[model samples]
Target: MVITYIAGPISGNIDINKQAFLNAADQLQSSGRVVLHSASLPVGLTEPQYMDICFAMIRACNEMVMLPGWRQSTGATAEYYYAKKIGVVVRDFNQTLKVSR
Candidate 1:
């Protein structure tokens, strides 16, 4: 199965962004897609720490599904570029899923 990682903003509005990530995950799962994400990262981690884990998670996936407004997120933007760099399929939730890499 090609696992898809959920990427979105989580710093300024953690609750809302996490919900968005979870919603994205649920939608993908309903379509029988396996998902990889760290929306529920362990507590007390710094921004870099969270991204460290997120980056590792993305490496394990075959694709990445970026949430709306991902470009405004430092982390999600990085994830999108990284996915392209490593050849992971990139798609957007704001529009129909299309390969960007």
Candidate 2:
């Protein structure tokens, strides 16, 4: 299966928007891909613990499908940059549709 990390904005009003992103992720997961979803993480974690899990999640995935607000969050943007630095296939939601079609 293609391991996919689903990245999205996860700060501030994350509690409000994350559910929508997870819905998208659920559809992606139906394809039999392993999806690394932030929703899977426990809430209210320390900064370092969160970062550690995020990094580990990124390392385990083959690619990333970053959601619309990814760039709006510092941590999500950093995750994108780190994924690129590590040579992981990183596709924004816009880019994904271009190829998926």
lDDT of 2 at 14: 67
Kindly report which residue pairs in candidate 1 clash with one another: none
Candidate 2 residue 48 Cα shift, in angstroms, is: 1.8
- For model 2, the superposed segments whose C-alpha errors exceed 4 Å read 97-101
- Number of clashes in model 2? 0
Worst 10 residues of 2 by lDDT: 92-101
**What TM-score fits each model?**
0.88, 0.87
Residue-level lDDT of model 1, residues 1-101, one tens digit each, is: 87889888877888888888888888787777788887878779887898889899899999788788888988889888988999998877755243211
lDDT by residue (tens digit), candidate 2, 40-85: 7888899778878988989999889988877788878888998999
What's the C-alpha lDDT at position 76 in model 1? 88
